[model samples]
Target: MEYFELNDGNKMPAVGFGTYKLTDPEETPNTVDAAISAGYRLIDTARVYTNEALVGKGIKQNGIPRDQLFVTSKVWISDNGYDKTKQAIDSSLEKLQLDYLDLYLIHQPYGDNYGSWRAMEEAQAAGKIKSLGVSNFPDYQITDLAQFNKVKPAINQIEINPWNQEKATVDYLKSYGIQPEAWAPFAQGYDHIFTNPTLSQIAESHGKGVGQVMLRWLFQRGIVSIAKSAKPARIKENVDVFDFNLSDDEMKQISELDRKEGVSADHTDPKTVLRLSKYTTNLNGLD
Candidate 1:
């Protein structure tokens, strides 16, 4: 698999397996194991996802050496302060059964993010976290955090798909030397993405699936993507994007399909911040 060199000088997988909704105790670990067996090295989980333990189980079951896998987890809003975030990091390590994480991110932009960043910096210095980043942060917030913090964020994980291209944000991130990682790369199948006429035509030409076309598009744009699937076939299919290449015309055709719409919660909305803050996790009983 191809890798992106982070601003911090760490290497991250270009394609990863996302575990956002893989919550079933029996299914989560098995699917994670299947993904690794299928050649996925980057495995993403989160404290809020409440499945870190299961993800850890899958990693152990996969029997791959710890150094060979790239594991990532996030600290939730409830654990936003320095003290709380510090504890949250240890809690995540315990739950993930990992001595260190490849990447650790501030899951959202709310609460005392500065405090959270400080804690993460400490963790990194202590060899607990390899890289530090933030998710769902706009250009301004990320810039502010980077300007004030000693360590600039190595990555910014956000929604990037056919519907919401995030062109300006992506451009800004690239210019700033920060890697942009795509979550919801397929837009979570929104607006019948897999069956869209434009993508379908492109896939037909490439002899691939619509999902593969989407991932290839992100790859050509120099964006890292994390795709999730419970089915073993689909999981394997998701990572099979390395073989094909989308032509310039096909890439433009897919870009034109962008509706400038987002599938996930709007980080700019106040209600989103309030709602997310209200949702608490049991990580070290922070709530």
Candidate 2:
């Protein structure tokens, strides 16, 4: 349950539950309920996730006070531009059954991200969004956005794991006082993440699973991490990382496991951007 202070003077949980593909419509609510009960205060969702309403339902069903929870959602690539992003924000609020979001992000760097950022700035000024940021944005893109806007991005959500540490990009963002958040922190199990021998040994030393060790590694590095799991036991394990710490040598061992570029799309590529912009999510039932 460790927390980090954003430049805007707000606290964000260092570890969060990410609802990326929890798309059962029905399963989403129950999974969210399990996460909250397991001591998760941060719930990350996106319009593309198609589970915002279910997340809201879970929050209400859990009966946790709104003030005690940290809710985050994102504007989708298809919903770019100032006007569309503004409407998307209201739609996200309605779907989440909340008045305001703890954090809101532009889901990608494509489309009218400049416009999308402007709309998020207005939303923040209006108190509808406490913190504004971008997910999957490269360092230069973040800088480009920050140059013209008065409110710099408070965070940058990126793919960060043992395989893809993103140190250069992360350091660049930190120079601008932007906190780095790790999505798919486990590398989605790619490259035999959970079964890695080094991580396994580290986990054994801490009496924790490899997943916990991975999160502990990120925590020690001062990065916020969101690990996704539908099982209540896994959810509990993800949040249980606060009890132990990874030694510098152990951390370096994990760092040595780095393969450099694994388990992420090349978002900077025009082909990828075009493909992502073409994909549309169906929020029909959830809405």
lDDT of each: 0.92, 0.88
Query: Tens-digit lDDT track for model 2 on 61-94?
Result: 8999999899999988778999999999999999
Return the top candidate by lDDT: 1
Q: What is the lDDT of candidate 1?
A: 0.92
Task: Give me the runs in candidate 1 sitting further than 4 Å from their true place.
Answer: 283-287
The alpha-carbon root-mean-square deviation between model 2 and the true structure, to one decimal in Å, is: 2.1
For candidate 1, give the lDDT of residue 16.
98
lDDT for 57 (candidate 2): 90
Estimate the TM-score for candidate 1.
0.97
lDDT of 1 by residue, 1-287 (tens): 88999998999999999998788999989999999999999999999888999999999999999988999999998889999999999998998899999999998988899999999999999999999999999999999999999999999999999999999999999999999999999998988999999999999988999998999999999999999899889999999998988989988998898888899888999988886777788533111
